[model samples]
Structures are given as C-alpha cells and as structure tokens.
Target: MSRFASTLPIASRAIPNYTTSEAGNPFVDGWYADPDTEIYNGLYWVFPTSSYSYDKQLYLDAFSSPDLVHWTKYPNILTTADISWAVKAVWAPAPISRNGKYYLYFGANDIREDGNMEGGIGVAVSDKPEGPYVDAIGSPLIGEYHNGAQPIDQDVFIDDDGQAYIYYGGHSRANVAKLNEDMISIGTFDDGTQFKEITPENYVEGSQMIKRHGIYYFMWSEGTWTGPDYSVSYAMSDSPTGPFNRLAKILQQDSAVAKGSGHHGVIHIPDTDIWYIVYHRRPLSETDGDHRVLAYDRMYFNDDGTIAPVKMLVKDNFADGQMYSWKTYDGQWTVEDERLTVAETAEAKAMLDTDFADLVFEATASIDYGLGDAGLVFRATNLSTSCDEFQGYYAAITSSDRVVLEKINGGKRTTLGEVDNMIELKTEHLIRVTATGYDIKVFVDDLTYSKISVTERSYSHGATGVGARNTAAKFGHVSVQRP
Candidate 1:
C-alpha cells in the first residue's frame, strides 16, 4: 500500500485526515527568517528575527510546537526594551537552555566600528523558555571584528563533553569561539586564542554547526542574501575545530516552490535519526527583501553521510488556523474543523502562494451546495475576481458522476478530457492531479490508475490551488508535492 493509503481512510471518514503529519509550510504565521530551532522541555522551539525594516526589527518572536503540525506563537518574546545596547536591527536569535536557565544569543546593530555603541553578539537569559529575556551582561560579548568577519549571525553548538561553541560571522568570513561556563563570556582555545577562523569554501553568512556520529558538520549560507541564488552549503570534519573542506549545497531555491531558501538551522529529534531543516524563503507572490517566511522540510542523508538535496513542498491540514502562505484571488475562505471552506460565489479561488511546476496537487474535497465542480488547479496564473479570468489546468469532480480535466486560457474553458466517475454529493473524496511538462493525469479516490488523462501544454509553470465554480466547497488535507 502507498504511505498515504495506510494513513488516511479512503472509503470513510472514521478518523482525521493524515496529510503530511498535519504540517504545512511556513508552519507559523508572519515574516520571519534565520530560524534557530531547538528542543526545549520536550517541545520544539524556533527563535527567528522579526522580518521587517531594519529600524522596526528591534524584537524577536518565538514559536513552540509539541508536534510539527501545531504551533503556538509568543510575540515579542525578547525585545530591545530588555537590552540596553541594542537600538535597532536586532537579527538572528539563537536560543538554548542550560543549567535550568534559557539563554538567547543574538546579533544587533549591524555594527562595523569598534566604538559603535554596544552592539555585536549579545546574550540574554530568562527563567522560562518563553521569556521576556533580559541581557545577561550589560554589554555586547564580541565587540570587535576578528579575521575581518562582522560579528553577526551567531549559532551555538554544545558538544557531548559539556563544552559550548559559537559559530558566527558575516562579510564572507566565518569564525568559531568557545563559550565559558558563565554562558556570557568567551573561552580560549587550546592554542590560547579566543577566536579561530574556520571559513569554508563559498561561505557567506549564517553559520551553523552540528555533530553526528562524532563528525562535525559545519554549514553556512552562500550567495547574495536578497537574491534567489541564496542557499546553504556544508562541510564535514572529524573535530570541533577542524581543517574543514567545503561540500555541496543541500538546500536551495526550487523555482517550483519558493525563492531565496537559505539561512537555516537543523533540528535532530531526540533518540531518533529524524532531522528537519528549519529555514526561511520568499513567497513567489512577494518581492521585498524582508518579505521572508519561516518554513521547514525533512532532511535526509545518504549512506555515506552526505545530505540529500531538500525539496520545497507543503501539505496543509488547516488545523493550526494559519493561512499566511495562501493568497485568495477571490473568495470568502475560512478554516474551521480542519477544512478550508469557501462560501458560495460565482467563482471562488484561492491559491497557495508557492509556485508549482511538474508537481502533484492533492486534496479531499466535497461540495456543500450549488451546481458546479470543485477540485484542484495547477499551473494557475492570472487569477482574479471573475470566474473565467485565470489561465491554468483544472481537474475537478463534478456534481454529476463525472471527473474532468480542463484547460483555462484567457477566460476560455476547454474540456480536454473527462471520465464517468461517481462523485457523490456532500461526500469527501480524494482528488489528485499530476502535471509534468505537457502530460496531465487526474486520480480521484482510487490511486491505482488515472481516471482522466490528457496532454495540455498551454500553462507549464504557475501556482497550485483549490477552486470552486458557482458552488460552496470544503477542502481538507490539501497537499502539493514534487512528482
């Protein structure tokens, strides 16, 4: 059986729909980036820079999830009101809990001069994980640039021997330093040096370090931060302080999904080999440099320990009541009872903001009322308020006993192919459509074979979404994945 077949009931709605573990992309709402993920008190926590104008980024927010599917946001968990030296541009918070106290390490001010106020890498402490953290010290920890690296984008890694190390830097330079037991001061290395430059090949910024199987995996971001080529690369070494060699990039922008996919942190599930890369990417509908949203995807490794390329995809159950990643072209959409429902309208359409191509869009759909079809749309573009203004391909289950594959171009609807399939009214049915190049295939409920297949080449690259024509429809467990 397929992985989804064993997880979801196809014949009846006896249990909840298991779609991507009920987790959606951009798992939390709002614009956030440079996510630092940690397991705190049996829950997953992410501390990210509140993406905004530099002057407006004086605070940081936190999100905690018991499971990857559900999240709770703690707004302004830490702000400049608690720090004396930070005035503006507080960026990239890294959080860790130690000795029963929670510590947050962050960079502020984008400082360049030695006497430029009191901003560099700073530390804050709180009694609880979700904290109104206060500055641990009255000043910045590393005030001066070493090895020509700007002191920003700091990440903490705790070794098995109870030693904590910080990897940070920007301006194309990277460094590693040890943290003292006080957790606020730097410690010297074995060579009596306080800072060691371990810059790897193609290193730009966003330094992250992890240890797996006694091997040190050093990762960093590369390329221009504001451009689509921004991505993550890694290197492996046997020691914490290593003769590091650069390796290939493991996370990058998929034009079919989102752009500028970089500045990431890794999370390793306790007692398991499971790993996830929590990062930020720009939605296709957005253009601002600061218009970034936090997202995550499963990370895999080859047998030889090389990481696999991460695929940008999303699966939404709508259980969290967060829909920041979607754009409603025209609809009164609501999320309740784990369903994305659209009220009755001439044509209701809302597309997930990610750009999809050569992908599979799947959702369990049912019509509440009216005489029309409800299903999935792919390569959808030029959407608007009118029913027939969009250009794309649609695969829908009609009110009658028929499933259809359609092509919509400049408001003109063309029925490419259709089949006589039973579409019971007010009954939940799984609808899936795969479009690869010019080939289109639709699968309804039964996944053994395509119910409707056609060759439509008009629209090749665009967004995937849910749509209803002159009807009220509710969709559940909507998913878009690379085919």
Candidate 2:
C-alpha cells in the first residue's frame, strides 16, 4: 500500500528556468488532466480526462501534434455515451493499439464498493487512434476492487515479449494484472484468482509503468491531489511484477512558476534515448481543483539508470491554439495534408473540438465548386447529438463574393451582419473572427468586414470549426489565438 500523507514529498534538484509558451503548456484550451501520450502514424496523440467534476467529467478528448509544440484537439473520442455501464468520473485512460484495433483502458465511476457496472475500470475499442471507441466488454473489466485496490487510474504496459499488463488503484493502493490477447479482459494465473496487489510505498494514485532497456520504471503520484506539493516519484525493478523499493522524486512544484504537478506518462521518442514526461499541473494563478492543465518536458536518466530531475516546462502566456475536426456532417469532407475540404456542395458543417470563450480564429478558405457560401464556426455546442448541427456564430463569404456574419442555433440561422464587399469565389482569402467579451468582429482578408455585439450569454463558451451552406470549400490553415 501507499505511504502517502505521512510521507513528505521528496523534492528534486533545481532545474534552471524550465519554460515554454503558455499555448504549448496546456496543449488544449480547456481543463484536462491525467494525460497519456502515444505516438502513432508519425503523430503524437494525447488522451486526457476532461478535468472537471465527477459528473461533468463524462467525456475524454485527444490532441494530436506533428511536433511536441502545437496540438489539435479531437473531442468526444470516448464518452459516457458509448459505455452503457459507466455514467461519470471517467479518468486516466490508457490507450494501446494492437491487431489493427485500438484499445482504450479507462477508469470510470470510482467504485467504492462493488456491483455490476456501477463504476470501475472498463475497456473500449475502435479501429482508429482518434476513435469513437465503444465498450469492448459488456461490463466493467474489474467491477470489484480486489486486494484493497481502488478500481481507478488504469495504465496498460505492453512489454517487449508482447505480454501486456494493467496497473491501477487509488487511496494509496495499486494492483497489477495480466491482460488477455484480446486486451478486453484480464487473464488469470494458475491459482485462478484475478490481480495481484503491487502498491509501492508512498504511492497515492496515477499508476503508470514504462519499460526501458529491460528495466521496469513503475511510477505513481503522491501528495494530496489538490495541494501545491502534489508530485511524482517512482521505483525501479528488473521484472514487471516487483518488490519495488521507493526511489527519489523526479517531479514536484516550483513556487516561482506553478505547482501540483504529477500524474504523468512517459513517451520515449520512438527509437531514441530522448524521453519526455506528459503530465498535468495547476497554473500559478488558478487555485481551483479543476484548473489543472496538461504539460510536457524532458525526462532524463542518470548514470545509474535512476530518473534525473524532470525539467518541467513552465508558461505564463495566454490561451491560444490550432485545431481541426475529427467528425463531420452531411458534407463530403476530408482532412489530409494540412488542409480541410468540404468536397460536396450541400449544407454541411464540421466543428473542431477545441472550445473557447473569447478568442480569435483565422482560416484561409477558397471555394472549389458550386454556388456555395462557407465560413468559420465558433462557440458551437451540442455537437454529438444535434443531428450533425450545432449552435454558434458563423462568419461566411457568399459565392457572390459577399461577406456575411450570422448566428446558428439548433439548425436555425439568423443573420447578424453582412457586407456586399465582393471577393473572388475560387481565390484563397483570409477569414478571421475575433470574439472578445460580448463583441464579435469579422474580417475578410485583412480588413474588417462586419461586426456585432450580442447581449445574451446563451453560447458563451463552446468550440470552433468550419461550415458551408451550399459550397465546397477548402481551408488551407485554421488557427485560434488568444488576444
């Protein structure tokens, strides 16, 4: 069992000026925590819990980056909508791909006791990395907390020998179990029991394991979750299942920048020795529990194979980002080669899962076919259920070269501002919208076209994406920046 609370956080040596841009630190615009990073198809994908309250944390979003710098949010990849047994408290998802299928191991509805699907660790599967993954098993894989381990914070490690194991627990306890080849359920030992208790001393929660050079690096988060001293420590072992002796801490808080940094996942650069730790931290300015955000920095190894002090990246800049859609509506759309295209000329729209309250979104759009009007969408909500429609503000350019600004609510369209300024249909033009407070400003190319200020906060914070009414449009690049 974990020896936390009574065990003080063992701090690391000071790292000099670990810093990055704010937009890069959080990785996404909203609150996200317990991030697990995986490299697939030459892109880095981060799956994190929607850092909210128990009931509100019903969905999980993913971010993809070509480099480790910029990320595109893919929201609602997995949610309570797909799991029949899970209702809320979806956290710490472990994703692995094998046999042409992507398996997501997650903890939901923190099951204090035990029951059918009342809340425990479960598995979901899909064919793609960015997936609308469905529950692979009909019920919680570990529906009951056996051996005093809490059925939460599951992490999966596939060893070099093709053997996979799941590590998890909470309340200062952890357990490990072998996974069957299907990866949907657990395998049993000759004794015919479930999992074995492997909780190391000082472990609190966030069980993550990584094997490097045949050494098992078993790590866990320690300290009270909501406090400034929340940090991470680890133990090393020669075997996956081990009598791990507690090692020194590699990550903790820097009072000068941020605090409460822990619950991390390690991503060793494909075949290189360069390692990075993907974790969450509380920004120095925010004192709330759900104010956590994801961040990454280099994790080095010492001469003796012990983990060196992690250089945690710190940023104080404002929120800004670039995002693309993972889902689309009745439009023939394709997102490849850094461009988004509405291939068919009919009423269709797509929303990039990155939500916002007040920010600027800019995209270069050009019409390729049909007499169609296409624009950018902002503050979009009710994305998954609304008949492929959403509610938000739309800044559009008509096929007749007219600039238009409107509001969309449940498929009902209302014009807010429109200008007769003509711009070529098939020519690429820069479209930009700045929504600050209640005022909305629309721009074409570089000039201000139409502006409107709304009184109602009905759609205060949602997502941003692209839309077209009756035109096939192609957007070269869409970017959102905080101003």
Candidate 3:
C-alpha cells in the first residue's frame, strides 16, 4: 500500500484565480507560498509575486487565509513603483522584525532586453505587518557591485545575537550576505561580505534560512521547477553565514504523481511544534512551464537538524473536516480479472464530450503485473466517421516507463510529450484530467504531464470507463466535476 493511502481524500480548492490588470498581474507562473507563515494582528499573511514579464518584474502581494484553504488578497502592500531600480520582477519577499520595525527583503531584476544578469536584492519597510511598504533610500540593497551582475530572491534572517543576514540567488547559484544594523544595506566582512555560496549545483533557488537548536538550516528548491526535474534540497551551517554543508534532498520527483516539487517555504505551528513545508507543483496538464498549484506537507527535522524526506500525503494524522470521495472516470470502459480499465477503442461515438469534465480516477493494478497500463482520460471526441477516427485528450503511463498524454486523431496516435522514469504501476496513483474547450490538461500523482490542443475534433459529451490491453489493472474512486 502507498503511504498516502489513508490521506487520499484531502483536496485543495483554488484560491487565487487567473486575473488580468493594467498595473498588477495575477500569478500565472511560479509564486512563493511560504510554509513558515507569520501571524500578526490576528491574520496570517503570505507574501507572493506574479512574475509577469521576463526581467522578473513582480508585485509582492499579501494574502490572508484564516484556515489556510480560503484566502483573501490585501489590496495595498508592496508595489513596483515604490522602488526606482526594481523595474522588472520583485519576488519572494521574506520579512523579519527587528527593533520594533518590520523589514521586508525581496529579489528583483532590472529590465534587460537581452539575456544577462540584471537582478539584485531590494528592501522595504513598514510600521505594521500589513503595510504600504516603502523602499529604503537608494534601494537595491545588494546589486551588481562595480559593474558586476545582480543577485535575486533575497531572504532575511536575524540570528540570536541580534545580527541580521541575507540569503538570495537562483538559476543554479545561491549567495549570502550580512545586513547593517538598520536592516536595509549589506555589511561587508573581510572578503567583502559575500557570506557563502550553496554547492553541488543542480538549479538551486528559493533560499529560505531558519535557525533552530543552534543550527542554521538553509532550505532551497532545486531542479527545473516546471519540468520533471523540479524538487527541494537543503544544507546546514554552524554559523549564520556558511561554509555550509549540503545535506540531502527534502523532496524529489515522484513518478506515481508526476510531480516536480520546488520553490518552498517552511511554517512552524507554534502550539503543536509541527513543521510544514509549503510549495507548488505543476498540474498534470502542464507539459511545459505555464501553470502551477500550491500544496503543503508536514515536515520534520532529524536529530542533527537535517530535514527528513517529504511524502506526498501524511498518513498518520488527518486534518479536521477533511473528507474523501472517488473521482469518476471519463472514457470507454471495460472490466476483467476484478480490475477496471479505461482505454481508447475504435468507435465513432461522440465527436465532442465534456460531460466527464471535472473527475478524478484512481489507477491501480490488481496483482503486480509487469508492463501494465492504465490512467484517466478526458476531453475526448471522435474525429472521423470510421471507428478509427478518434481524437481527444488522455494522459496515461505506457508499460514502457513513459508518462505521456495521448492525442489520438483518426487512428493516428500522437504522443504530445513524455517525461521519462516518471511512471510506476501496481501502486494506486491519482490522476486528474481537466478539459476546457480544446485545451486538455493531464496530471498524474500531483505532477503535470502535458497540455495539448485537441480543437480538431474536440469532444463535448462522452462516456468514461476502464480497460486493459495486455495486463489487468484495477480502477476505482472515479469522480468527475467542473471547476
């Protein structure tokens, strides 16, 4: 049985829908959802960004969620025009309190028409937790020094000695720097105060620094955040600034869910002493770098302060009011050997089927069968009069170690895209297929596989069932809906 077997019913509802604005943009891509949330004035605030343009220009928006599931946006917080040099993206704002004032540090980059490092760290200040945060004088606290390049994704940490340090950088490298007493500017040490750099390079970014039991823990997101490689890694430092040692991976690619987890934040529950890591995952339909959703997992620290490996769902404890229901399947179905299977058969049934729109399907194998195939199907429509004419949407793991979305058109099967070493049978896997018009999105486990265009013969209504080709597979908990 999978570790997440009992926790299968917890579902996350969408908080912030896609929005458009002339001045501010809704987060369409990567955004920070810190797990280590700060509670001020009876509200929990989350600082995130909408990286709309390439120069990485973003607005640090504040959201308050009483229950963590439902969130409301704070209209006024940090805006781009507050700082002059922060022209492009303003992201990952980490705030700390010192001397009765709140210090907000973030990552920013100047507009570069060509590919180059125009990124740096910016700081803002406000008297209250929720604020009209204003940039300090001569903003861009840590910029490309003397015609060098800039640093991005700045996180501020204040140690026990009342000293403050900044950690930032992304795109394979991370750097740490010290801050002056005012908590705005960088303070240089002997080597010009470039604290330390993270190593074992593997696309490390989103650095969040925390201190516990005399150990400085550095957590970061590694791998391509939108691709199959996305995950989280960490390191340890004796002092606030390293010579830090790379520890181990806290999260990684789970073939069962097709998830690439990265760009995380840690939250410690004061009452329970429970630690939670908040991160984002690409939806199953995400083939490239486009859409993503936020998720949270309980985290724990080992005896030595190193983080334990993360599981997709927690099995021991259940959240309050959490319930489970099966996702209905959408596709032609079949049953054999006590196993339910969904497959594409040659039949000129419905040209466009949207009836099975919002559904979840559980794909499992009966008795460990090698080279077995099964998954959820959606956005299906017949393309031609002949039974061979079939084209719609479906993401399935072939018996061949490949996870892909099958776009079938008139007997022609086009594998939209595939992520290798990312699919395993025998264990029950959660599959979510979302279809809107001709746009079809498929996600396995919690990771996205692909988003394909099936406008040619898109299905408006169709029936869904399970079947197996060569091996027997079990299908259950099929639920469908429209979100």
lDDT of 3 by residue, 417-438 (tens): 5666455656666655665555
Q: For residues 245-324, what per-residue lDDT tens digits would candidate 2 score against the true structure?
A: 78988999765335799998877666567778888988755768987888777788888899988754422221232321
Query: In model 3, which regions exceed 4 Å deviation?
Result: 1-36, 55-57, 110-119, 145-150, 190-203, 314-483
Local distance difference test scores for all models = 0.85, 0.76, 0.55
RMSD after CA superposition, every candidate: 5.3, 13.9, 14.1
Better of 1 and 2 by lDDT: 1
TM-score of decoy 2: 0.62
Which candidate should be chosen as best, given lDDT against the real structure?
A: 1
Tell me, by TM-score, which candidate is best. 1
For model 2, what is the alpha-carbon lDDT of residue 393? 82
Error of 1 at 38 (Å): 1.4
All candidates: TM-score: 0.93, 0.62, 0.57
Sort order, TM-score high to low: 1, 2, 3
- Cα error, residue 209 of model 2, in Å, equals 0.6
**Residue runs of model 2 more than 4 Å from their true location after superposition:** 1-23, 114-117, 190-192, 315-483
True-structure lDDT of candidate 3: 0.55
